[model samples]
Target: MTESDLTSNFPQQSGLPGEKRTDELGMRILKAAQTMFVRDGVDAVSMHKVAKTVGIGQGTLYRRYPNKGSLCMSLMQTKFDCFAEAINEYLRDAANATVFERLSRVVSSLIRFSENDLDWLKAILQSGTLKDAKANIFESPPFLFIRDTVQRLLEEAAAKRELVPLDPAFASVLITSSMTPELMFYLFDSGYTPERIAERYVETFLAPLFAGAGRI
Candidate 1:
């Protein structure tokens, strides 16, 4: 996505009460933080260093992003927005594709997104941001977008009687849970490449669920 798209997707209420900053400044901070994080690793970078790099006061940076977790979350949000848009665009353009094909691609996309943003995700988790009600990630916009998309596709397959009768809602929740950062990290630690994980996920989960249709 473009810089504007990232900036547009930035959370307005990311900081403490009454925390406010211009979009331009927010984008600048995000860019600076991301650069430092990518160059030095999230664990090595400090909020003070980020402010120094951005030529902003530490207090100003703190007001906009109370912690590294909040900053990482904002960065992840931008990536999530791009991920959501890519899936939507693919679905729209793949109107001729079978529900099975579309679903597989969507699942693959989600896997890739998780793998690509693993660093930021890990940082966010370690930062204790996930404990916040406002950052309850499962209910976040981008995650919900993908989860609903997956459910809708499952519902479509069910409607056509192409799959075994199943509860799409529960199935979607299960499938999305598999792709979470924590699970993905475990799979990675277990020596699973992203490609292998996607393939195995489809085979172990989707193939059986969709067995009735011979989509596998």
Candidate 2:
């Protein structure tokens, strides 16, 4: 996949609430699945195992999540919400910061999330069911939020004469292209610390824009 394609933008799926009892049961099933996946690895966990672990019938588990992909998507939804919230919070707090500084902070946050959730994300991407579901990661809500945030930053910088004129959408894509899991993992494995990766990312992709500004 192209770098842009690899950058997923899936929306968070919300659980339906039929009744209090059903909601509680669904929570139990989801918790069991998460626990098992973390303890035994995603590839080793199955619907049957999760049902047995949660003491629920296989049919019941299937009713909630027809396949591993559905369950994985639900699991990731919560994480993505938190991730999005963190970025929002950071931007709010850094309102007075320079565009470069704000961009650096966002990059740093993304690197931290990638470092912490690499395995979980890998499992979701490797799931055949998710692929078959044809969920466009680029259209996902969290991704869209990140993309829009970056675009806004780029536009702001250009408006403020801190960056040369450019298409914000294209610039946002270029910035996020470096934040993909594959590239991030390669950099991590190559002995680049997360901080170092963030620094280099800013230096390579952003510094020149600011340095040359109108000249560029």
Q: How much lDDT does each candidate structure score?
A: 0.82, 0.75
Q: 12-70, model 1: which lDDT tens digit per residue?
A: 55554444456668778998887677778888999999999999899999998888999
Query: How much is 85 displaced in model 2, in angstroms?
Result: 0.9
Clashing pairs in 2: 8-137, 9-137, 9-138, 9-139, 9-140, 10-140, 10-141, 11-140
- lDDT digits (tens) for residues 1-216 of candidate 2: 121221233332455556656767776777677677777887888889999999988998888887887787787676666677778888899898998889878878888878776666666666655565445867767667778889998888888988866788998876776577778778888999888988888788878878876422
What lDDT is obtained when candidate 1 is compared to the true structure? Answer: 0.82
By summed lDDT, which 10 consecutive residues of candidate 1 come out lowest? 12-21
